[model samples]
Target chain A: MEKITSLADLKRIKEQVQSKIKLREQSASAEKLVQIRVGMATCGIASGAKETMSFLIEETEHQAIDAVITQTGCMGYCYAEPTVEVTLPGRQPVIFGHVNRERAREIIDRYIIKGELIDGMIPVNFKTIDE
Target chain B: MKTIADHILDIVQNSTRAGANLIEIIVVEDRKRNLYVVEIQDNGAGMSPEVLKQATNPFFTSRKTRKVGLGLSLLKQNAEQAGGGLQLFSAPGKGTTVQATFQFDHLDRPAPGDLAEVFLLAAIGHDKVRFCYRHTTGSGSFSIDTAELAETLGEVSLAVGEVRRAVAELIQNNLEAIGATR
Candidate 1:
């Protein structure tokens, strides 16, 4: 592709990105697509959330799964560094703790693809304002 | 938060959110001046003058999800605590540039942290946007542009597992070649 230099070109690309993200967002609220959020705080980074995130993003795409992966700040789960929250369509979001590349792949293959909930789940103990 | 790289990640997220397609991250270590400078320039929808005035205020935010924006404020505080400062230049409908400086050897200064991760995250998270990362340590310098990498890959997505691994290794190796260790 062409190198984005001018403001117009940048805006064009931004529109494309925004459209893709919009699809993901619409899917999240419409309960039509799987949504994944990887924690990327300082603690998460130190524990290798970057690798896990890359794995999920790539693996999901490679597997041809209709999932959107996004980054998030710390979830106050520092003890469970490298955490990931996965939300299947029409289901409650599940927070997975201590995720690595292997676990990321497993999440995609078993939990995400097959709807088989594996280990590394950090049980929700508190309620949110929306709740 | 704990490292300069973390601050960079936070600020760059702002750029991506601002609809930037090109984000440039420059790190310069000037031993002679005992200064470490990080500059993030983006061709995003810049802020209005009214918002620019309070971009560094912890109480200011443009997001509806929260009432306070602490990224720029925390970075400014970190730089100041290390005997340096942060500067933001932006214009409505133009773009934004954030320059943060820290004392090179200040005891309070945090390490640069994992920059390779930062680049990789930005690359994969914003696949459509292009990133240019340059690191300079008085000795030498190295720069990598995602657009150039994409040209080399020829239609391969950086989100691919092998490609992601290669990009991360390339960043690590290039930084090492230039003696930019964190």
Candidate 2:
């Protein structure tokens, strides 16, 4: 693949990606993009949050999901390291634990895309991964 | 942090939490000089003298949720283990800068994990804040300024799939070009 070396290259990318942005903007929920926060603290990184985060970024890109993925500090759920909090449009944010690459894909497919809760949905004071 | 890339992400989070609107990550590797330097500078809410004094202690933290702040301590450990040291500078309201230096050929130096992935993740989600990365090796140097990238992006978000891919590729290619290790 060719290297992206200059600001002109980014300008070209912006032009190429504009059509897709326009298509989404024309929809009723144009202002709403899925928001994902991956924990990247020591515990999260130790548990492979970097891999989880990179996978989420690639998967969302490949699937063309209108989502913004970002990193956050630990959410006090160190036991469930590599946790991901997903917020869909106006829905309440859902945090999923033990979100390895497999679980991240499942979250995107089942929870974010289909609006169905998966097994890893975390609740307060619960250690599901331990049991 | 397991690798230099991981530590970059972890410490950048600390800057974000401090309400830093501008974060600078710099890495310089010169084998001839035997110097491997990693620095993070932020224009965030700085720490007080008392807090700064104990900042490297694992048990001292500003967050109410936990009693331990291991970010600095761990980085300090990593630096010392690699035949270098960590330096910190901060003021009450100015900002904070964390710099860690290592011997370029030190056996204990952590591997350079994935710099591209780390850079990509750092720039996303914080539209208001700007993250700039400057990486240099003996061969050459490369840099990414979010302010310039934002101008090019216009209203498009950095997290957009194609844009994200492009930015990641840009960082990766630049890193390789500069003779940076993976």
Candidate 3:
């Protein structure tokens, strides 16, 4: 697999992904359905982000929280390298820091399931274009 | 490193950071049989035999800034905890493959996190590396070739907001079909 080196290369990749959109939709309906984002920046990896992310994935399926967990690069908070942002349907996105499997479970239970705010949040700073 | 995706993103970085020109990420989910597998392969400067053997140890790292390398070690642990396992294979100059498997029915098994976002990040974040993402669920599967996507968009960033949203929607629909819901 050669790394894509340019925007041209990326465009080509996206086109390939588009053809598979139908399959993706089918899979989503059959499997679990929650949106999870794990920070995988260099700092995050160094801080045990892998374990944290995997924990979230495994647990969601185990508990069946209607979830789809994925990874993102560099949330820009190096100090909180292993951070996780979870968003359930009809809920605001919540960012949790220093998360391990234990914390992941708590987030799933309290936030994802019960819609309760948990303790380890980094104050929201950046605003998306939507906001 | 507990979640499979987190572990994957971290490990994949090693390949990119090492100047890997091509990277492939494959994810398979089997609902009928109850299994989920993730494999990341890269053609970068592979680790030496000795380094490969020690890569799973928390204390061994190739980086100078840190005295410990917990990425692979913690990933292995997370896999085991979820009634799954992890493996790493590498050859100097050839490339490396890291695979992790989980029993979907196990109480410890995690859910499928957002993958579309991950794919976009991998494609857009690293301008010099090529990423190939293949996702499968039971009877169906799809692939994303960053190189191909780039070719289609032309003179524009293929990873634009629209592309990101579409990918996200695609993932959402796939998970839904599989009866995955939060």
* TM-score (chain A only) for the predictions, listed in order: 0.73, 0.78, 0.69
Tens digits of lDDT, candidate 2, A18-117: 8767554454363488888888887888899989988998898788787777778876777888988888888777789999999999999999889987
lDDT of 1 by residue, B21-137 (tens): 999999999999999999999999999999999999988877664466777888999999999999999997789999999999998888998897788787766777889999999
What's the distance in Å from true for residue A74, model 3?
10
Name the candidate, 1 or 2, with the larger TM-score value: 2
| Superposed model 3: Cα runs more than 4 Å off | A1-42, A45-131, B174-182
lDDT of 3 by residue, A39-95 (tens): 765577668765676567557656755565555655456676578877666556667
Model 3, B1-182: lDDT tens digits are 43555566777777776668799998888777677788999999898999889988887877654566666777777678778899888998889999988787787766555566556666654656789877777666667677776566644443344455554565555545544422
CAPRI docking class of candidate 3 = incorrect
The model with the greater TM-score, 1 or 3, is 1
| Highest-scoring model, DockQ | 2
- Candidate 1 per-residue lDDT over residues A10-63, each given as its tens digit: 334444444343244333444667888887654566687767876787788788
Superposed Cα RMSD, model 3 = 13.1
Q: What order do you get sorting by lDDT, best first?
A: 2, 1, 3
Q: Give TM-scores of the second chain, every candidate.
A: 0.96, 0.96, 0.89
Candidate 1 chain A lowest-lDDT run of ten: A18-27
Ranked by DockQ, the better of candidates 1 and 3 is: 1
